[model samples]
Target chain A: MSKKPVKGEYIETDTGNKVSRRSQIIGTTNIILGGKTVIQAEVIIRGDLLRTYTSSNPGEKQGNPVAVAIGRYCFFSRGCELRPPGKLYKGQFSHYPLKIADHVFIGPGSIIEAALIGSHVNIGANCVVGKFAIIKDYVRILDGTVVPPNMVIPSFSIVAGRPGRVVGEIAEGEVDGMDLREVYREVRN
Target chain B: MSNKRQSMMPPAPKPPTSLSSSIVIAEHASLTGTKLIMIGSNTVIHPRAKLNSAYAPITIGSTCIISERSQIGILKEPEDEEEAEPVVIENGVVVEVGAIVEARRVGEGSVIEVNARIGKGAVLGKHCKIGPLCEVAEGEVLPDFTVIFGNGMRRIDNSGVEDLKMKMVARQVEVLRKLIPSNIAKFQ
Candidate 1:
């Protein structure tokens, strides 16, 4: 059966973000947190925390350090795995990095691979953000996703999946706030 | 030098006729650019869209709607194996605008929504809603009423689908096995 998250419970984003389906925020689990350190979600200061040790190799990168610039009033679902930003590789090989800005709403089962993600971005469920991908601000991605490596996603765009094609640009002045409580309510009913 | 009257007047352009849905095709749509093969009557197809059957055949039942601005790429295997047949889209399926279906069969009452993509050799069972922008990967089979709307790795990482996709090259090896007609006759 497909694993879906229950309502009002907080799942920690240790080593990775919560990547489950339809988790709730009303229960004892308050913060969807990451890491063994004391830095808790919804309490950490909203800014770039340069805590990740950049390494080009996955073998060299130990203990999965993820850097988060989480903003106020944002909703994150379960099973979202946010690995550390930027893989700094030396020598004559291709290198990749992931940069997530503030107020980014990531859905369940989404994989962000060394991507440049801007603020106010809403990523749909089960999407794969490939290496070196650039996603601009105010972007909404639909479900069942695959973004190829080295591709650029402009601002205010809505992308649906299937070999990942860009259908149309979202019009300006359409600011939709993605509240976790609202999404949780919708999923429960 | 024969002073033949050169036909200076361009031949009168034929008037555009309102295409009826009931026109009988002398050749199948496979010969033309249409990938969808309609079994029943009263199916409508837009003029602007490109329906290609180079890879597979899309079979559609009667009373289907192939909307405008939809590009159907009924694709076969990327590297052709001699044995693989065309893809099929069964009858009574509605493919919306901007939806692309590359599969062999989309069963009856299945709706491939706008901007949705059904991958090569994928099967959509009856009454399924392939939600907008969803990507159903190659050879992935969905049972009836299986509403999948998001992207995912076809199987759990390197073990399941990675092995299956790699073995896809041998799918055409069955054609060579069928070529020995004399051996079959001896068995009979």
Candidate 2:
């Protein structure tokens, strides 16, 4: 008889992050997960691609060493991937950190290589948010949308299509539904 | 091409019927119901690729590459059908990273790219290219040399340039064989 993988299989971190053992997370040391986040099975967070370039800004060291910084109450569904964006700057290859703000929900099979994703963003299934794209607060990306590289998405907007465009606006009252507390509670075995 | 004939060496070698001894399956791969799966010689299944043949038998031909997070025969066969036929993938196919192929037939030298989905009962012909992030709808039939690309666009690519692609895939398979540890006995 084949044994079924047990449901509600999650490890509760000291910071309240519920991570699945089946998730393939490389370079865990380079990832910073805030409290109450959920990383589901088959989710890959690639932290091995670290920044090789020194800080070009004033008063900074060569290697600060952070690849992925995810905020509170974020839910990464099964088969999704979070990859840090990399580029050649000054003829040197380097990867930048993927910064995700609070209350974000990424659906299954989606690939995120965005530089910045603001709070309360809900990206639907199989969407691909491209490299260095900046997304502001309260954004909802419809299922199967592909957000092109370096694109900017404004707040309170709903985006869809291939190379995603603004399709609609989110009502002010709908903001509360974006809270991930209920979703977090339901994920428990 | 020599590997193709060797894989067809008759059903007499039938004691260990399903899983082939010549295939390289990663130790971490989840192979549920191995009795329902048949992998030809020189196939390299990357670590973490899920091949669940519990519902339907899956037959993958020689020198195929199943990449990480890619799956074959994993999804439950569509419920409405009275009986779902087994999936058949012919020789020299490359199923790339994160692809989900539940097709009825994947022909020779086909390349299923990253994050692509081949829906249930789809038939992809010889040297077909299913581009990254694309989706072939369920039961769709694609002829040989068909190239499906960005945003559901498709066209026939009959330039006959599979030699370079096969060489690159072979090199990738060589690297993967060294990178991922194999445990063929675990499923056998």
Candidate 3:
């Protein structure tokens, strides 16, 4: 029997990130991906919506100008989008950075416009995380959930519904399953 | 030699659509169909937004923000006997991510939230708000200040804060103009 060599589907970067060739990542200069991350095909990461407002403190360091920052062992599934949240503040409109911590997994076709997502978070398919929504650590957002704008989700919560609300809690033992380290390894390409 | 030189210079191609100089259209935004698409000044069209004018023309007013994956245009042509009306979006309208707008007229300062669908020929009055994932049936007419929200609930917003909201939309357009680099020449 002849063995066929399967072609890899992802482009592995030097920093141990596996990014698909078909991903539509805009404004690449403003995006920071930590090592061991996997970005699947057709995923759109909008890093162009950077903060336009400047602080008054001239002496303070400008620091990093990143618009979308994702930490280690994260996974973005096919057709998902990551967009920084923007709002009108004090009569000025500015986009805030989307910060995602380690071991996060976002499912297919989900549109995330959250300001912050903590570690070990798993967002299911076709979900919409609204503007400035803060999802804390070890949370599971079920499929098709539409989290309202400015919602703050606590840790270890299971959120579901149109205007998403915490329907249940994630047990301590189940928290281990939320980690995306194993899922990252499984995407060999 | 003079004839050869004249032959080498190709004629300039005519632009298919009309766009104001101050509008910001991203490089990846799709503008399809044979009919004319007229976009006014200070409008920001995000990447991957689809504007199809195959069945009828589309007129988008000033200071509008059309977000990513949102589709604008009529779903189909009108019946053989009737004429297809153009899709009209007035000033300060906001169509959020992944929304489908096939409205005959989306009134001034209206907002269509993410993933919502405004069906064919719907006439929305000024300052209407359609919430996320909501569906407005085809040819439906919504009054001014109508807010369609959770579980298809309807309400009228009489807070008299429309001026403030319109100001916010204008500010958002200003910020987006700087953030989204426009390649209007490519579309032309």
- lDDT tens readout by residue for model 1, B104-165: 67876666754578877787776666754567888878886666554532221222232232
DockQ of each: 0.03, 0.09, 0.65
Ranking by lDDT: 3, 2, 1
User: What digit string (tens of lDDT, one per residue) describes model 3 on residues A58-157?
Assistant: 9978987899999999999999999999988777889999999999999999999999999999999999999999999999999989999999999999
Candidate 3 retains true contacts at a fraction of 0.77
Sort by DockQ, top down from the best: 3, 2, 1
Give the winner by TM-score: 3
For all candidates, the clash counts are 36, 0, 0
Ranking by TM-score: 3, 2, 1
DockQ, computed on Cα atoms, for candidate 2: 0.09
True contacts kept of 2: 0.05
TM-scores of chain A, one for each prediction: 0.55, 0.93, 0.94
lDDT of 2 by residue, A144-169 (tens): 88887799999999999975899999
The parts of candidate 1 lying over 4 Å away from their true place are: A1-189, B1-39, B76-78, B150-188
